[model samples]
Target: MDQRAAIPVTLPRDNPTQSYWQLEPDEIADLRSTSSLPDKADTVIIGSGITGAAVAFNLLSNGARDVVMLEARQACSGATGRNGGHTKAASYRSFLGHQKDHGTAMAAKIARMELANIRAVHAFARDHGIKCDSTPCDTVDVVYEAAQWELDQKAVKAMQDAMPDDDAAKYTLHSREDVWEKFFCGRGGDESVCGGVSYEAGSLSAYQFGVGVLKLCLAKGLNLHTNTPALNLEKLEGGGWKVETPRGVITAGKVVLATNGYTASVWKRFQGVIVPLRGHVTAQRPGLDMPKEGLPGTYSFIYEGGYDYMIPRPKGSKFEGDIVIGGALAKAPADGLEEYGTTDDTAFNEVIMKSLDECLRKYFGDNWGADNSEGRIRKSWTGIMGFSPDGFPFVGEMPGEKDLWVSTSFQGHGMVLCWMCARALVTMMGDGDEKELDAWFPEIFKINEQRLRLTFRGRLS
Candidate 1:
């Protein structure tokens, strides 16, 4: 689809997350020595993370010219770069909802679309040569520790029955056998209940992915700036927009806001739709001795009381040594772990550590390797993600604004191609159908007049 002509917008800012992504020595050298600020453009993108990068990459490739990207900090400094790096086929939660609201077929379609997006992401990566160390594996969605096998069974059955025909051969329904046989476990499992759902997904060094996108855009003459934050936005006469910052002003016909968690306060209407929520994540330098069978499919980091996730990087490929176990401990009642995050690495102090520690005690009990094996806590930090009451992202134009659009708030799993989210938004902005795109996402984002009444009826915040 071709977009109408519009001036570009660019803001200059330095990259802020070179260390977090563990940039290769060479990439780091280039980034350190080659940073620049945003310049003038026809269209100004407000973020430099995954979604912004994707939109810019696609927009530029789609023939939009003179586009510039602006970031408050360095690229990938947001959730894009901070995620657990697992790209799976859609949301298990979304699938469950589909089965409930529309039935098995609709839920199947949702899963199929998600699975297809996984393949699309990989295919695009290959075609574009965007190397982010992406790894494809089947993930197992384990039930809550005390939950039953029936939970996993019932969940996977709905998924399997609703899955698209193209991916039918790519999955399997197994009892704990798949989890047990594929990845040996010393302890901490219940045999009688819900099993794991095995399906192929991908993982990558997330920061690298965003960095690569920025590099690609830079190569394409897309003027980008780091550190330059848009301080204000002025609606220009004749149907255009101009963004003001401490540095300068950028005039563009339209603005695309992809600021997920760190969404700016410059825009009044957007203030409500985008809610920034802080999430805590901890990564150890390198711990754990891998089993001979290799790492099990990485999936949702779930447990009894807290959520946890672990993945081995391609750097060692499980042959060398060192693994990182990361998950949510709890909010320090003192520090308010839920709203405001604990910057201290030891937030998992006694209180917060109980649940994960107990899970460890049950399975590895004094297990060496997981969390340093000697029960040592490594590094922990807070990253923010846009949150919503119902967990749906607002991916269309500002409800009543003209020529202004947004793609914000992904709660946790943005693995789904929220391309659908953006696609719907863009389509609606350009007078195209957004139903299919809207269907794949959470129900609350639909733009109809009664959408609110239907979605959150008595649940307004």
Candidate 2:
């Protein structure tokens, strides 16, 4: 059988590795269009992913009214909803990449911003009652050691070297023994996290978080529309966007394009800019050794490990069942199932399923729960994020369009980056300095001066 045919969704589940919040199919939109938009508004935002929500939330918080949020699908169905529920205050693995490409200053600033996001999420949760099942558990970037691990450390130090003096305070360095005590004490070496960096952030329920976010937006009186895909988009006379949807037209003064990966056509030139990419995951019976419902909070990452994340729900400690997971669909397919070297996970395959089972077995040891077998693989999803030919993602104007901003291409790391992206975009669009932030921190965004042809375009470079 072809390896491509062996796609992980054997039972044909939906985004198998997704957590509890996303297990259910996305909620449908009720479109309070109980009435229509007043033909005009100061600003209108499209695509309701976390980024769009964050932008809406930030703008609302900043006292901007007449702000409306529209969702082509239900809120969060895009990357904001379909993403790994994992949340972090710092760039998890990409900080290293940030250091290499941008330099120390940018990298450090990105790191600190992540931490702030965690604080912001919790604060939002408490104040606004956005019940995303937010948690305070800190996450660890663990490694098994070796030169690669050290190089990752050097990236961290370079970040420290670039951060302002005050921002650098409270940074910690854990020894091998300390790492073990804090994370893997009494654990087997094969599963041991030899060394790691602790950052003050963890995962959240994406679906729940999205609902909370959307609900908040609704409360603010943001008009919403669903099942209304923006098929045709153009700039309006009053210096805004005119998006033609299947059901109605969305004309607004300022358009915040938050389509992570969907069918929203902004500019004819940006058609190929946001090509759709798919990612997958698998779930299994909890291992016997897996900590009970509420185990002390710890989100650990293993170097070279297939995937780096496993979070138990709040009930695990309170005595509710725990959800353990590892692995996302590995190889991105080239073209179709027969092709390789790309990410096309249309259906389930055995290769990923077996690999994930092995990872679960290894992490939990001989303790996987009996009868629990494997959780039913529920849904399969594909998200479209714009990718920068350069390794990192893009956040800024819509290539050739005026007054249009695009944030897409998350690779596999959208959760943390999305928030950072939204905040940065808002700042750039408005008059703001890094006042709340340190001066040593460099902005994470860079304008792509040269417009390259898109990957999905009919013609190639």
Candidate 3:
């Protein structure tokens, strides 16, 4: 059987594993602006995750009120809440492959755009005083395998040569001699296993971030309806869309599909192009006596056949600052494509669970969990991510669909780029041209016919 075969896409799964971020449900989790759905709205945003809330906020900020945001479940309950909570951007890790895939100029633009979004998020969190556990820190891309490390070095050099002034390229690549200190800092382990590169990055609780933005939007007259699934969308006779939900039908001048992995449920054309891949995540608290200050910054461990990302929880908690970790798709069955088009986050694979169980011990050594009292698994869950064939998000007016814009298929990097993408998209939604919003978006992210014609082989790397 072809593992890459497409599956019937739908809304988010009913019962998903709860993430640590949702440990304390937000006031807006299941909020509805009104007891019943409104009949009309100037703009309707489907999917109240990070992307949708961003669009709604920006649109309202730009004086476009009467915005309605609809969600299938609780607000930000999908990938946004289920994510690892890391907000770091791609420094030079994917620059080489992206350069090869989309050309040097476009790749540089993508890298720069990602970094800019990181800054934008930090600024938003600071300016709004959003207590989303926003942590502005550096990220270390620790490479353990010899081959990948060498490739990373070459990629960084190439990126520097191409865009010398690129801030993303302004990272310190540590060698074996200093890699251990740079990575562990006398915490994870003392052994000099491999090397890594460190650069500016940030982390935060995405659920809180989204809720904060949604709260502001609601204050500005944004109507949000939770547990309201957008069952169908029909083009109105004159100039709008009639969105059908279980609650009621609502007409809107414009609709933005920020649905991400569940996009195909509302937009059928994204069937093969936007695949929903299920990923597993784990949150573990340190033992009663484990050192809390050891793991300071966010980390991405790149090994020979697998990779895992981890972000530490904030200090002073009953759980004693658990570590949220995910990724290692390489260890998944059938080259990981077996999960290519799955919209199911209700079940998690045992194989991936076992891999995640042993990741910290393998990378950080025995210090992570020497005994039962030291390392305790707290919560484990699964989330779905939208994967685009071209490995870039579709962030513009849906091709051939008037007034229907989409900001989906972020390929699991939504936290790092969705804010800026939404900001630029709202501008595009206005009378502004691509040139005016060029600084906030990459050219390849734009939805066009040529991209729509390409064969999608479930390539998410």
Scored by lDDT, the top model is 3
Query: What lDDT tens digits, residue by residue, belong to model 3 across residues 386-425?
Result: 8777788888987777999998888788888798889888
Q: Rate the local accuracy (lDDT) of all candidates.
A: 0.55, 0.55, 0.81
Off by over 4 Å in 1: 1-20, 23-40, 102-106, 146-148, 164-171, 186-194, 285-289, 304-306, 315-321, 329-337, 340-378, 418-461
- Per-prediction TM-score to the true structure, in the order listed: 0.77, 0.77, 0.94
Model 2: per-residue Cα lDDT over 306-382, one tens digit each:
34466655652321345445433442232222322223334444554454445544443344434354442333333
Range of the 10 consecutive residues with the lowest summed lDDT in candidate 2: 4-13
Model 3, residue 453: what's the lDDT? 65
Candidate 1, residues 343-362: lDDT per residue as tens digits?
12212354444433334323
Lowest lDDT 10-residue stretch of candidate 3: 183-192
**Cα shift from native, residue 16, model 3 (Å):** 1.3
